[model samples]
Target: MSRIPQLVIANGTVVNSFGRRHAHIVVVDGKISQLVDATEPVPDAERTIDATGQLVIPGGVDGHCHVAQVTGRFRTLDDYRTTSTAALWGGTTTIIDFGIPRDARETPLEAVLSKKALAQESRCDVALHGSVVRWDETVPWQLEQLAAEGVRSVKMYTTNRGTTMADGDTILKVMREMVRLDGLTYIHAEHDPIIADCTAQHADDGRIGIEHLHRTRPELAEETSVKETLAMAQYTKAPVYFVHQSTPGAVDLVTEARARGQEAYSETCPHYLTLDDTVYGSAFPEWYACCPPMRSPETVAALKQRLAGGAIHTVASDHSCYDLTQKRERTDDVRAMPHGLPGVETRMPVTFTAMAEAGSSVEDFVEVFAAGPARINALPGKGSVAEGFDADLVLFDPSVQRTVDGGALHMGTDFSPFDGRTLAGWPAVVVSAGRVVLDREGFHDPGAVGRFVSRNGFREHLAATADLSAATL
Candidate 1:
């Protein structure tokens, strides 16, 4: 029989889906078995982590990331190994990244399997969200297959090269199919016609500054796309997730849609909450460029207010890093740069600082970073430190302060948009699935053992449906 490794983390404040509390956690067989008062004697175990004066919170679930995925004309730097390593160092234990199918030849299953092969050596748990590139008669069947393979979510773009830009009918069809399969459909909401026209107009006038990218893809573009997407969701009663919602106006739409009992939700990124369009005027404007480009300070303030007031469901990094050479190539016309920035490693610290500054409780942070993401993705036994849950935990030091340097970070990228900024509150220790992966000094000697979780609960529903379909035939 395999030995059940016993360990006790004592005198730490535990923060879970419920709230923060002072308790001692007992770990056995790589799972949390009990949480009791700190005054109790520390159980004899293989090891004891003395967490006095520290906060122990559930490890983050990064719901949106672009690890090893490629955008048009550019490829990402961090692959599965490097990206998950970086995430562990930053206190995230699980990631839900996009498995985008090749527009030319590959099927969704092939793409997802290929990515899984690449991620087999990861250091943190992983799951994939399939991106729908081609919407045809076979697309619904493909989605069902993906769900069977443990991918419970599918992504569709309203505007992207080589991806399907479905009309209202196609969108409705996809929504209905996804709903019937009991899978979540994530949409990249943006008006393609408006963006194309604005880009052409700016190209003609030679007004392609980094600042102008926002004007080209204005709030109206997002607003209109969100309206149309919600309409389709309403028509089909499909659960829709709006990715990287940036503006206050867009938040209002999502708020209203949720109120109407529609399963419409939105996610915002760290870049939108911190950086704004003015950053584009800096000496290295390309460093701040990203899709759904940064907006005004007013919008940022409104987003903060909305997030604090519980309007926003979750926050993600949306991290996509390219080499510095790729970013600098578009120095002349900011539109030429690859649209993304590095944040997977910085997301936790930055958000923690922001929440502290806003006087928001730690419970609120746990909801957005842990519970909400895991629940939305239907990840079982994750997002908490209760009994029988995986021991994915982070020991945080609220007093420690540090400065962010893009060049010094572990990401494969060569730059960071938040370089030189000091942030309070940092993760002192990170544990994933009962193994200690990172500490204050950096990564430890534990070998990479992360595995792809075949989601059991929600994904099982898809398999059951497939069986029923065959039986009916």
Candidate 2:
């Protein structure tokens, strides 16, 4: 007979994909087996966690994070161990990180395998999004192979340094191929030509301040790129996802595209919704810098409304952190600093506060943070806390208040843009696969049995529940 480790999370309000309600969740054999009334008696099992007056919700699924990836001369501060530790502390149990190809050396699969190997000892579960650098004939075959190995998503860049931009024909080909394979294509939307033109113009005019970063990129750049990507999605009938959408114009484009029955979805980061161009004018502007630069306060408010109305599907940190030494070097020259922010540990709490301030329900948070990301990644047994789902849960104290301090966070980053800001609703207890990984004190351990998840057989599963109409918007 096999032994069952039975544990009961008693007297807590259970928040799942459906919604939040008071219930006692029973965990047996590392899976949620039953949900009973909050006052239910604990069965004869291993242990019982009293979650009175706390919200027991599904562990967060961070759909976008950059762990152990490098850019230019600066390497990311958080590796698998550190990043996963920070994630666990923040109640995020699963991560979908990017796997960028090395410069002209290894194949996509080879690069993914190397990242997988590096993340083998992660403290939390992980998945990969195979980033396509130079799209070519051989790329499709490599993608198919990656899909076979459980890598279901491919990332294509529209504008970046030293990266090949996929023209219309190439984008159409890749989109069609992904649709045929029942996979997803994630796009970094920014018009290359417009951005190049703007950058050159700004350089010539000597208007290269941190504020000029937004001018060079501009809202039109994002809008044009988003419109183009939506058109391609319509042309090829592929499920398209826009990563880190930053402006109102881009949001409007996605809203219109979804109305047309196109499969277009978008994810906006915390930085875009919280920070703005004023950060660029701050004494330490480099700390708040990122691609698709933050827009005006009006754009941020619009993003908040979109999120509340379900116009936006997902929220991610885009948690890419680099040390101060490298970040400051770009302060003098806005283009030199790597584009990213350190946010894996803060994505959840910050969003929760923002939504709560807007009178949004916990259902809204669950939909955007947990369910939407899992569905996008095609991961089963995740995104929910119902019976038969993985026992990944977070116990939140809605009244707990804390100030954001980057130096105090567990990630390897040296600072945080959100520093000194106070927020409410923090995770008091975190459980991953029926095991406690983080509590009020800190992480349980550095190497606590995190695993690399394979993407095999995910497409068929997603196809069964995929609402093509809902996916596009």
Candidate 3:
């Protein structure tokens, strides 16, 4: 018989989507059992975490990331074990990663199951977004099977041709099928033709530096794809989520879609909200390269406003880390450089800093970083600190500030995109499933403590229907 976990976390302000309160939390059998007033006596428990003067919130949920992805020539540095360790230390208790299909023979269901198997090495709970690389008679059936098995979202790409890109017809078909299966379609939106043309133009002009990668795939590429994807979502009566949205134009498209009552939501990354295009002008700009690359500071400011106003739904770390050597291998050639940054461990601190600086409250922090992700992706027992919820908590000190160093983080990387940057609100202690996985010292693996979560919730956040096809763009 398993021993009942008894833990008491005291003298902290419990922040959640509903509200905030000074309370003591009780955990029993890996679930939040009670929230008593702070003035009340501490409950008897085997373990106690003193959270005095700390903001005790539900652990963060990173909804989009690529872990141990091996695609043709591109591969992420950190696999499930290292990624989950980094996430725990960073205050994220759950992460939703992609199960990308590598070949035609691999079905989406098989890919998702294989990915879940790999995540068994994780120390934090993990979920998967199923991918469809090819559209055939079997693809729709595969999507239905995946949804039936608790995979609530499917990832599709409108860019990266010759790799994961799906044509317009394929994208439309997937969206319609997701609607039929009661799932969400997550899209990586970028117009392939625009990217190809821009790449050829830059190459012909002999401008192949790392900065040119961003120049080649400009805002128009993302904006155009988002517009088209929204149109399709409207036509098919399917909800769509655009991942790593960077440009104001793309934001505008999402806003318009929402106004037209299309179930369109988007997630922005820390790099997009905090960093700007000037990184491309830095001496070693290759380190800042990523898909849907960072934009100007003005755009960042606008996106921040939207996020603060709840125009944007969630913030996720598109955390795809490649070794520094891999990044520098093609510093002189923009097209060959690996595109990604080590960000899983930095998402919470960076986002917390952004929100606090904007005068947002801890409730807002819990909503965007935790509850919103759980509600959107339908990860049960996550993203909240209420009774019956998973006892995943973070004792975060908002006043504490620290400079980010990649080598110091648990990810498999040599550098950080936010290196040397100081941010407030660091996680002093982290708990996962009622287990103390991270303390001041470091992470402690709890013997395959992470479980594969099969998600099914797909809550609607928009008006019912408005025939957006006939509406103005």
Model 3: lDDT equals 0.85
lDDT of 1 by residue, 231-294 (tens): 8888888888888999988888999999999877889987888888888777877887788998
The deviation in Å at residue 293 for candidate 1 is 0.8
Q: Which is superior by lDDT, 1 or 3? A: 3
Which prediction has the highest lDDT against the true structure?
Answer: 3
The clash numbers for all candidates, in the given order, read 0, 4, 0
User: How high is each candidate's TM-score?
Assistant: 0.93, 0.95, 0.94
Q: By TM-score, is 1 or 2 better?
A: 2
Candidates, ranked, TM-score: 2, 3, 1
Q: Lowest-scoring 10 consecutive residues by lDDT in candidate 1?
A: 464-473
Measured over all alpha carbons after superposition, the RMSD of each candidate to the real structure, in angstroms, is: 5.1, 2.8, 4.8
Model 2 lDDT per residue over 1-473, tens place: 75545778888988755657788888987788988876567554587888998988888999899998876566787789899988888889999888887575767788788888888878889989887776577988988888887888888888875743556666778787788778888898999889988988988898876657877888898989999889888888888999999886787788898898877888998888778888877787778778889888888888888887788889999999787777777565666677788898898889888888777788789878888898778887778888788899999888989999888998898898789989886788899988877776666884648767776344576674455324422
Q: How far does residue 239 in candidate 2 sit from its true spot (Å)?
A: 0.3
